[model samples]
Target: MTFLLLVLAIASEVTATVSLKLSEGFTKLVPSIIVVAGYGGAFFFLSQTLKRGMSIGVAYGVWSAIGVAAVATIGALFLDESLTAVQMGGIVLVIVGVLALELGAAH
Candidate 1:
């Protein structure tokens, strides 16, 4: 359950971040609303996951890394942003680091 909540939080955060770019410095109304609500809900669920058994450092690290990667991917795919090879490699590294942290926490 905690893991599920963490995943949801990560997804919500990613969505919020992507929508933020669309908000155009808050000049746009609808995307701005999504950004606000999405972040609020994401944090609420993240807090709940922390209250469960997940360590703060681990949970936050994983959530942030995943959120960044997801947001970058969305930007590249939907916004037609170019993701250079180096950027893709960096994202892979972030995923690997998160996996390493999860494995370390398991033991």
Candidate 2:
């Protein structure tokens, strides 16, 4: 359940980040609203996960890493953004680092 909440938080954060690009420096009203609401939902769910006893370090590390990768993928797939091989390698490194953190926390 806590992990689910964390995943929701990461998803909401990534959505908001994508919406931020669409907001055009807040000129667009609808995307701006989505940015605000999405971030709010993300933080709220993140707090819930923390309250449910997930460690702040592990949860935040995973959340940020996954969120970055997800948003980058979204941009590449839907927004016609360039995702170079180097960036893909970096994303893989981030995932590996997160896995290391999770594994370390298990001890």
Candidate 3:
């Protein structure tokens, strides 16, 4: 349940971040509202995940890393953004770093 909540939190955060770009500095009403709601839900679920006893390091690391990667992909795919080789490598590194954190936590 906690893991699931954490995933939700990450998704919500990513959605909010993407919406932020679409919001155009909060000029757009709908995406601006979405940004607020998405971020609100994200923090709510993230707090729940922490309350469920997941370590802060693991939870936040996973959440942030996944959020960064997701947002980057979304930006590139839908927002006409560039995804250079260096950016792709950075995304891979973020995933790898998260995996290493999870592995380290196991023992």
Candidate 4:
């Protein structure tokens, strides 16, 4: 349940980030609304995860890592953005580090 909430938070954050780019410095209408709502949803869901007792260290680490990777992938796929091999490797490392954090947590 907690992890599910975290996933929601991650999705919301990613949506907000992508919409942020579309917002064109808040010059657009619909995407700007999405940016505001998406961020609001992200924080709301993230807070729910914390309230459900997920550790902040683990949750935030995973949230941020996954969000970065997803956003980068989306950017590359649809926004003409590019990811270098080095950047890809860094994404993998971030994910691995987050996994390590999760695994090393006290059970």
- Highest lDDT against the true fold, candidate: 4
Worst 10 residues of 4 by lDDT: 98-107
| Candidate 3 lowest-lDDT run of ten | 91-100
Per-residue lDDT tens digits of candidate 2, residues 1-107?
99999999998999899999999999999999999999999999999999999998899999999998999999999999999999999999998998899999999
Q: Residue-wise lDDT of candidate 1 within 45-89, one digit each (tens)?
A: 899999998998789989988888888888898999989999999
Per-prediction TM-score: 0.94, 0.97, 0.96, 0.97
C-alpha lDDT score of every prediction, in listed order: 0.91, 0.95, 0.95, 0.97
Give the total clashing residue pairs for model 1.
0
Q: Which ten residues in a row have the lowest lDDT in candidate 2?
A: 94-103
> Cα miss at 67, model 1 (Å)?
1.0
TM-score of 1: 0.94
**Residue 38 displacement (Å), model 3:** 0.8
Candidate 3 stretches with Cα past 4 Å from truth are none
Q: What C-alpha lDDT, on a 0 to 100 scale, does residue 86 get in candidate 4?
A: 100
Candidate 4 lDDT over 28-80, as tens digits, reads: 99999999999999999999999999999999999999999999999999999
* TM-score, prediction 2: 0.97
The runs of at least 3 residues in candidate 4 whose Cα sits more than 4 Å from the true structure, single-residue gaps closed, are none
Q: What does the lDDT read for residue 84 in candidate 2? A: 98
In the predicted model 4, the residue pairs found to clash are none
